[model samples]
Target: MPKSKTKKRSGTDATENRPKRSRQSQGGTPVNSASQGGGDVEARESPLQGHKCLWIMGSSIVHWAERTARLDDPQLGFTKHNMSVKWKGCRGLVFDGLDKLMDSMLMEMPKPQFILIHCGSNDLTSEGVTGKMLIEKIQCSILRYQALFCKTTIIWSSILQRRYWHYAPLGAGKKIEKKRTRVNIAIKSFILKNGGQYIDNNNISAKEVNLFHTDGTHLSSLGNSILINNWKTALQSLINSTPDNSLLTLPTATL
Candidate 1:
């Protein structure tokens, strides 16, 4: 759960069973960005009530966070924000796999208010893949998702730099880095142009050493914390900037 309210643009009268601040978030803008752990002072206990939902989707980086930080735990960081937060990711998942994953999600959950995607790193490392090819595929997939979920917002997260390219040959780090940069720039451009938010992870690099694990593909604990903080900042800005949402607070109910 986030320390923010669900930005519900359209829906039937959802039972208002959240806190007072969440109810207020609907009429006015919210400005709380719980940078890092423990979130905001408004955070509440489990079983929050909300109409909109959030989904954080990706591969290793996301999966690692969920495994170590339980980032998806709906009760972990519920500040006045009234949306249920869920995490979906796994190790070695590629871009195409992401499409399948999201499609599968439709069968299990309602349309989400936001979906944060942080995948494509694995595909970047796979032999014979070029940035151009990957970018085209990603563009199609993202567009499909956007068209299907007309009301939902899409957040395109950039790929992180790796100390090592898993499937590439020795000393191919630089080549992979170049491709990754090109892919990120191109993707970022498309996302911004076509109505999507972008989160850049260039601040976290393999060069930092402290930010990465020995495996070089995953992030260290401290690294994940930083990544999450960045997300908080970006998402809070996006949430607060949106206009005209009405929220209500009824008795608390199980998620």
Candidate 2:
């Protein structure tokens, strides 16, 4: 198949329109363009290796270097690299989150054959956001990714439970936990119904696994192992069933 033409944003250079970084440049700012609805559109690329799998997500992924390197082992034929931007609560939903990621990936030296995306916990944590709305946003994001990277199989990772979610002042944390549950349900339904692969991080971490830091927003070391192992299982399942890459090619999982 021919390479898909990359969609462009306003203020993008007509010639290349690529970000300056190699794999990813972690930061708090958005890219240098504007979307149709006035969302910021910054995307940075990582150093490209010969691997065809690309993982993209928010800041939480930056800390998974050791585990991700395991995916690059020659036997697996998967090279994992991340292209994450700065994260703030609900900013991903407000901005064209996946679009930014696509821009970032295309800027890279290698195009991915499989793309895994794990994000939107911030959106779910934001107050007053309905599970339905979060579901819609995620579904739309998946469609956008498929449209741009039609040849790649997209795997959607579930939002994890925050261990400290119930400790926030005024019971705000409890509310967040509820919202997360609702959103996760919607996400699982949507992904499975749409023929996209969904990894249930919640279930994997629920079994006496201390999966988060004391702050409850990030993954602990053991949690990282659990997350990566889940990704491995998901990918391995797909590979086992589809010995020939007919409809889907597997990709790296983003945290």
Q: What residue pairs clash in candidate 1, if any at all?
A: 3-81, 4-81, 5-81, 16-250, 17-250
Candidate 1 residue spans exceeding 4 A from truth:
1-50, 71-79, 244-255
Candidate 2 structure quality by residue, lDDT tens digits, 79-148: 2333222211222333246566556656553445456576766565455656677777777776666555
Candidate 1 residue-pair clash tally: 5
Q: State model 1's lDDT.
A: 0.64
Give the C-alpha miss distance for residue 127 in model 2, angstroms: 4.1
Instruction: Name the runs in model 2 displaced over 4 angstroms.
Output: 1-51, 61-96, 166-169, 204-209, 243-255
Could you tally the backbone clashes for each prediction? 5, 7
User: Ten residues in a row with the worst lDDT in model 2?
Assistant: 24-33
Clash pairs, candidate 2, are 22-45, 22-46, 22-47, 23-45, 23-46, 23-47, 31-42
Question: Which structure among the candidates has the greatest lDDT?
Answer: 1
Q: Scored by CA lDDT, what does every candidate get?
A: 0.64, 0.48
